[model samples]
Target chain A: MSDTSFDSQTREASFGDYFALLKPRVMSLVVFTALVGLLVAPGSVHPVEGFAAILFIALGGGASGALNMWWDADIDRIMKRTQSRPIPSGKVGAEEALALGLALSGISVIMLALASNIVAGALLAFTIFFYVVIYSMWLKRSTPQNIVIGGAAGAFPPMIGWAVATGGVSIESIMMFALVFFWTPPHFWALALFMKSDYSEAKVPMLTVTHGRKVTRQQIFGYTLLLAGLAIGTGFTSLGGPVYWAAAVVLNLLFIKGAWTILRRDEEVAEADNYAAEKSFFKLSLLYLFLHFGAILADAVLMRMGVTFGGLL
Target chain B: MTFRPDHELHKRRKGRNIGVGLVLVGFVALVFLLTVVKVERGGSLQGFDHTQRIDMVPQGSNK
Candidate 1:
C-alpha cells in the first residue's frame, strides 16, 4: 500500500526551490543596507534586538521578492535570464509563491514590530506593498521609468534601519535613502545596456527597450552624474567620515569615467568588441555601491571608537 | 502489499519534513530569545508588575 501516492510525479518540488522564491541575492543587499542604516544612526540597540531587526527586515525583503516572482511569473517564463527560476522551471507553483509571500510578509511585519518598533514594521509593510503592487503590478509594464520609480522600494531599507534605532526619520537617513535611490538607475541601466534583448524579448519596458541604446546610455551618464554628486556630497553629513569621503571621491570618479566610456560607444564598437566596456561597467557598479556602503559602515565603526579624522586610530 | 520506506517520495518527504522541523525549532528559539531579551531590557515588563522601571521608558521619550 503506497500511502505516499501522489497524482503528479513531475511536481516534486524541493525546499531549496521554495527558498529560491525569496531571491536571496536581493535579500542580502536589503540586509546590508538596512544594517548600515541601523549602525550609523544616532542611538544604539541591543545586539540581539539589532540582529532580530535585520533578520525580520531581510524576511520582509524576501517576502516581497516572492510576491514579485508570483506577479511576474509570465514574464519570468519568457525571459532567458529568469528561465530557471523556481516558478519558471516548474519547481514551485505560482499560487504557492503568492501564499508564501503573503504569509511571510505578515509574519515579518509583526515580528519586526514586536522585536523593534512599530515604525520599522509599518515601513516594512509599505515596502512590500510598494514593490509588489506599485512596482511589479503597475509600473514595470506601464513605463520605461519603472526602475526609477520602483527603486524607492530598494532604498527604504536603510531608512527603516534608521527608524529602528532612532524611531524616526532624519536628514541623515534621507541622505542614505537618496544615495541608493540615485545609484539604482545607473547600476540597473548598465545591466540593461549589455543585457540586450532580454528585456525586449520579455516585453519589459526597460529604458533600453523603450528609448534606444543611445538614450539609455545618455540616461546612464545622467544618473551617474547625479549619483556622483550625491555620493560625494553625503560625506559632509553625519553618515560620512574621512574614510567615506575618500571612498566617495575615488568611486565617483571611476564611475563617471566608466559611464563616459559607455556614452561614447556606438553599436558598431559595442558589437565588435563584445560589449566589454558595458560588462565591466556593470561589474564596477556592484563594487561601487558595495564600497560606498562599506565605507559608511567603516566610518560608523571607526567613529564609535576613539578614532579621529586625519589622526591615528 | 507493503509500503517501501526507501521510496523516492519518502526520501524527498524526509528532507522536506526535516527542513520544516528545523524552521519550527528555530522560530521557537527565536521567540524564546526575543522574550528573554525583551524582559531583560524591560521592554515587555509593563504588565502585571506595577513597579516603575526606568528602562521601560521609550527610547524616544523624555522620561
Candidate 2:
C-alpha cells in the first residue's frame, strides 16, 4: 500500500458527512409511507416480517438516493440546495457512494424477498431500477416531466406493502399508488416555483426551468384537480371509511386553494418568493399525504372498533 | 517540488488498509448477527398479536 494521507487530506470526514450519504431526510418519508401501507392493508403479516420488510424498503429507498447522488453529483454541486451533499462536497467519493448504493440495493431486495414475498421483492427491484436508471439517468436531464414519471418509483412502496399483505395488487393498492403518482407533479412543481434559479443553474430541466412559471403554475392546478379526484375516489374503496373521506375532502380543498394562490400571483410577488403560498402548499402537501394515509389507519382502527359507517346513511 | 515520497505514502496506505479491513469485518459480523436473529424469529422480531375485533358490517344491519 502507498501513503493515502495525502488523499485523505484531499477528502474530509464527519458524522454529518456519513448521514448525508444515507439521505436521512428522504428516508424518513420512505419509512413513513411504507409504515402506513403496512398498517392499513387488511390481514396480518408477522410482526417480525413486517418490521424487516419495512427496514429493507427503507434501505432500498436510501440506496436509490445514494445512486441518485452519485449520478447527479455534477448538477448537485451547482445547485444551491444540494451543494453540501456528501459526494459533491468531497466527503465521500462518487465511486464509494455508487458501490455502497449497489450493494445496499442488492441486499435490500434480496432480504425483502426472504422476509416477505417475491411480489414485494420484485416491486422493490423495479423501484430501484426506475429511480436510478429511468429517472436519474434518463428523464431528469432529458425531459421536463422527469419528476412526474420518476414519481412512480416513490409511489411503489405502499403497493409493495400491500403486496406483502395480500400477496398481490388490487384496486385499493393501485389507488394508493395513484394518489402518490398524481400528487408528485404539483408537490415538486411548487418547490420549483421558489427554487427556480437552482434548477436553471444546475441545468436540470425542472418544469419551472424548462417551461415558464405560468405554464408550470397551470399544470400544478391541473394536477391538483386530478390528485383531489383520485384521493376522494379512494374513499369508495374497501380501504376507506367516513374518516378517510372527510380528511380527503378537507385536505384537497386546501391544496387546491394553495395552488390557485400561486397561480394568481405575479412575478414581483412570486419572485419576492412569496413562498407564503408556495411554502404553505409545500408543507400542506406533505401533511396531505400523511393525513390521507392517517385516515386509512383511522378507518382500520374504526373497523376494528365496530364503528362501520357503510350503513349509517 | 520534484521530491518523491512514495515510501512514507506506502506506510500510511498500509495503516489505512488495515483500519478499513477491520471496519468491514465488524460490519459483516454485525449483519450476520442481525440475520440470525431475524431468521430465527420467523423474519420479524415484532409479533402482531394484539387483538382487534373487526366489524365487517354495521351493527344491527345486514349487507
Name the top DockQ candidate. 1
User: How many clashes in each candidate?
Assistant: 0, 7
Question: Alpha-carbon error at A270 in model 2, in Å?
Answer: 2.9
Residue A183 of model 1, lDDT score: 92
Error of 2 at A277 (Å): 1.7
- Scored against the native two-chain complex, candidate 2 gets a DockQ of 0.07
Error of 2 at A129 (Å): 0.2
Against the true two-chain complex, what DockQ does each candidate achieve?
A: 0.44, 0.07
Off by over 4 Å in 1: A1-7, B1-5, B43-63
lDDT (10s digit) by residue, model 1, range A1-313: 4444653563677778888899999999999999999998988798888998999999999999999999999999999889999999988889999999999999999999999999999999999999999999999998999999999999999999999999989988899899999999988988877776677777889888789889999999999999998997798888889889889999999999999999999889998999999999999999998999999999899988969886763
lDDT (tens digit, per residue) of candidate 2 on A60-129: 9989999999999999989888887888777788988899899999999998887778999999999999
* Clashing residue pairs, backbone N/CA/C < 3 A, model 2: A2-B9, A2-B10, A3-B9, A3-B10, A48-B44, A48-B45, A49-B44
Tens-digit lDDT track of model 2 for B2-43: 977565445545665676677569646645655666556543
TM-score of the first chain alone, every candidate: 0.96, 0.93
